[model samples]
Target: MTDAILRMRGITKSFPAVKALQDVNLEVARGEIHAICGENGAGKSTLMKVLSGVHPYGDYSGEIEFDGEPCRFSGIRDSERRGIVIIHQELALSPYLSIAENIYLGNERRGRFGLIDWNRTNADAAALLERVGLRENPVTPAMDLGVGKQQLVEIAKALSKEVRLLILDEPTAALNDADSRHLLDLLRGLRADGITCVIISHKLNEIRSIADSTTILRDGRTIETLDMHGDGVSEDRIISGMVGRELGHRYPERVHDVGAEVFRIEDWTVHSPTQRDRVVVDGAALTLRRGEVVGLAGLMGAGRTELAMSVFGRSWGARIGGRVFKNGEEIRIRTVGDAIAHGLAYATEDRKTYGLNLIESITRNVSAAGLGKLAKAGWVNDNREYEVAERFRREMNIKAPSVLAPAGELSGGNQQKVVLSKWMFTDADVLILDEPTRGIDVGAKYEIYSIINTLAEQGRAVLVISSELPELIGICDRVYAMAAGRITGEVSRADATPERLMQYMTQTEEASP
Candidate 1:
């Protein structure tokens, strides 16, 4: 291993009524990829912010040393000036700008007389794009690229700064399997070029494959750091360290009888909203029984989410043709309000955008889906709303100062819980959770699983859509695999495995016309 390139000693940060980090210590060796693992709100992001100067120097107490020199960063620009760059989970590129413009956005090339140099800038951008394995034209607009290509643009932008220490926060959270593998390979190439990296991710498998060492944190405190190569570490051992306990079983035990089919969809077909003739969801059909936890597994763009959204309230696609049946009687859900009235609720995958109103307090967001239950004579009862929100907040174990806290301030896990709480408040009989545990830590995943089990035990039908096959096998009783906008196969929990599910996921793609 190389010598330590960055060291943060006795770092501490606090917010109002919350100590985000306390006595946190981190050390990263030069030319190595170090991972930071922790549950949501466990200070992983906070620590990174402190390092990248997002928290600034005076806002937190810490001793930072970079390349044997004591350094204090007053802002992100200050840190970037010293060869440090951070790419947040949300990509920071401007959609309207071209690739070359985004790469040299604030830091641009100048020709004679201090004017912009477009030719040299595009040529430099093309070279950087080639280095990052992105083949798109430098003049292509950022909005025209896919998520995977956009990620490459971010990395190219980072390289534009002559970055020495690169930090990636959940880089693969939004990528598909192929894109994820490509990104990992690119990280390896970066490491070969002698650039040290710090990656924050919930995907343990990716960490095991790419990281050299991992630092485990729990509740704002550093627990332990393990050498991935030398120690021969297993994922379970890392999970134990992050959660402070051994998880013998990935899923909680559930005891509930699956009753009659509570919800059913038949001959569902949704065409592309823009293309009109392109079919996004093709004749998909599914059923969920009361007290049953069913899973929909597929690759990204497999139409799982498209089918759910179309069925919920025709919220997606242009030409949608589907028949939904509740209690064996056909129902027409023409709008979101109609779907909610019919006891159907959808917990969206993108919680930041579609799930919660981030600017609003927890009280309002929790009661948002079920305002009619708390209204008196068309006037919302303020005290009733507060009481309901507070009850769900406590039940969901939301880590916040109070119910008045903004939904955006909480971590990813907490935000998901709030979304679940909002759906539960609606008293929906059938719940569709899309990528319910996508970006949360292992500990938070277990908590969310427990909540799903509790919902099943209460005789509510739950349908989950997830990309991780192991998660489906862990929490679901039955798994349905989708591919190319069709239901490819279904398996019982006793017969399901990652390999089996993956085969089903690709079966239709291989046979596509």
Candidate 2:
């Protein structure tokens, strides 16, 4: 018998208009950690669905082999019975349920009285949670845990079914640096326990550290699966395989002369809504100049987001006390609408909730911010709206079926483009893009960088907030590091290495001697 644990041959999936997957093949050896590397909307998730039976047979043309025998998975349950479990990127867990209950939800230990045996369930859950490096009490509600802990709980839940093959899709995308490292360590432990693992992520650093082999996908086809355990494997080799071409530069070139200050903050402070005495943003003063992309760098909870939102209007925090100036003149921004009217637009980091109306069509979303301008006598000019949206659709290169496509149906990267287009239509001179490339793929990220550069060249003052230091270093002329609710230190792009930026980022005002 072959040593392969899972094999997918000639998988093909098509939608009404687009062929999502085209003749893809993959093989995972027993007890090996494999990674799926691809750009956004490159059929990586679709291939995973086919492997896990989410697509099922007849929906796609594919032959799947498990343990050297032919198998057919009609649904998620069918795949689960064979020890195949997949944990999605957006975690799926009951918030109200206790950790123990969530872990043993569907499969429970029932007594003679037809009631669940809580003792047995907790005992089993505790053991599994320990294996996943989660020490939280089993009785604690799942909602009380952070995203990292919740992800570990999901892993425990998957292991409760005694899974042999585990699939994780972008597991660390929502996690912080420490949590991401802990999760990767847990994956290594699972592999040592003889469980074969498959991970799909755009984070090449983590893949280089932990994966034994990686499969590269381009467009709708599998490029190749290179062995990382061998001597010839490297990130450059993997990147070439995934992109199908050599990259001359990782980041686009930036050339823009900084002009006079366009916007400024003086003695800004914000009190948390829940805790009145607690200050989230304290005396944070900064400035943005014309034709400049200034980077805001900080560890989580350093008030980077709070400062942006507070200045953009009273979009965040309570008891806001600040002085904002535009072109050296004071501006009254009491509401978000006022901020927009004053040539300011904020793009949130959490795009799904704060950045967009997901249920609306892309055309409506793009025109939502500019409706007043497009309206004539309290009636929207349909022809004008269509023309405006069509122009942006072409400019942004939004890969959608149509402008009338629901934003929810679009991919992560495309949705982001639409968000940018929304603000672009408003003709805002000062743009606050909070984590603009948070969840996008590499190719899309390059496009975003180019767009930012173009905006700067056009004399728009761009304020970019990013957690990824390398990103800020690449694009911004200057970067400010925040710590403990204040701007700590500013660095030039040439001097903005990860080490120097992180040192300023983690430093606090109340540090010990």
Candidate 3:
């Protein structure tokens, strides 16, 4: 404790209607990896904002000490000057800019004339990239790299500032397993170099493996901080602290009341949108029964998402050919509107980009897809829209002060709820959920699974696309694995296992459906 590099005492922050944090305390030792664990809307991000000066000094009440010195940061720049940097969940990189340019964006390398020194900048960036284990060219555009590489770029940028304390928010939320392992190794390397890291993550297993100590928060208050190296610190212990309850079951159970076949896709084929001749989904087919929950499992680039989007309305492919049937009758769905008209809905995986309008109110976003139902003649009923949105908010347990709150203001889980509410308003008979619980805490994931069960019980057919095999096994009546753009294997709940699914996912030849 005497060697603590950062100490935040009695930190209290409040917004217009919500007291986000109250009397919160945190301490991080030098050159150690610390983790913050909490559910969505549990004040984890809010506390970090106060630390990084995103909320500023006078905006909150707190006592911050850095390196045995009282610190009062007025802005992010002030905090950065003291070697503190925060990398938010959403990477803030200019896509059009080169990797070197993005790295030294604000803190640029200058020559004698006070202009940017391109040669020195690229060379320095290349060295940082090597340190972060990325082998990409410094001149390459940031947008050209995948999400995992972009994360490395953000870290390289932080390193450029000679950071002492590096804060990462859900660093591995979008990464594949291999990429996630690489990032974790990089964090360990940084720790060895005498750098302190405070990570906010929902991946408890990662925290248990890497973190030296962990602090738990719930409902805008500090719960407790546990020593990872100490005894009796289990994943369930962390979950209980974060949710304020003993979660006996990570996934809720629902009685399987599957009915007759209600939806079918036959001979579905789609070519890449940019490369016209390349097939992304090759002759994929599946069937869904009424009041049933089906899962689609695959590795990255296995065409799971592509198949869903193409089936939704040819939304992401060229040369799309498919026959979609509802209630044993063929239905034409060439556009999003056509898909909706045919009682089909597809929720995208990237909720921020393709799902909700972050700038719009929750009510507006919820009513966006089904305004036709709330409209009379040429005029839309605003009152009806509000009522319907409020109904969904209550029913879905969306945590927000009011329906008028902007979608961007809510947490990742709440934003996803808004996305589901938007589609639910359409009263679609078939719901295609793509990564419905990605980047959310265990508690929020349970709630989402419960919602899916509710949808199935209402006689709606649900198709879920996921990367997690256990989730599919836990919630689906049947799971189908895809490999190389084809259905590789199909198994009922009783026959599903991670090993069997991986065998199917790695198959070179497609298996019979």
RMSD of 2: 1.9
- Residue 164 local lDDT, model 3: 100
Candidate 3 at residue 123, lDDT? 100
Give lDDT: candidate 2, residue 78: 89
Local accuracy by lDDT, each model: 0.93, 0.89, 0.94
Off by over 4 Å in 2: 510-513
TM-score of 2: 0.97
| Tens digit of per-residue lDDT, candidate 2, span 66-106 | 87888888999889999999999889889999999999888
> Which residue window of length 10 is worst by lDDT in model 1?
504-513
TM-score of model 1 vs. true structure? 0.98
**Predicted model with the maximum lDDT:** 3
Model 3: lDDT of residue 324: 86
Ranked by lDDT, top first: 3, 1, 2
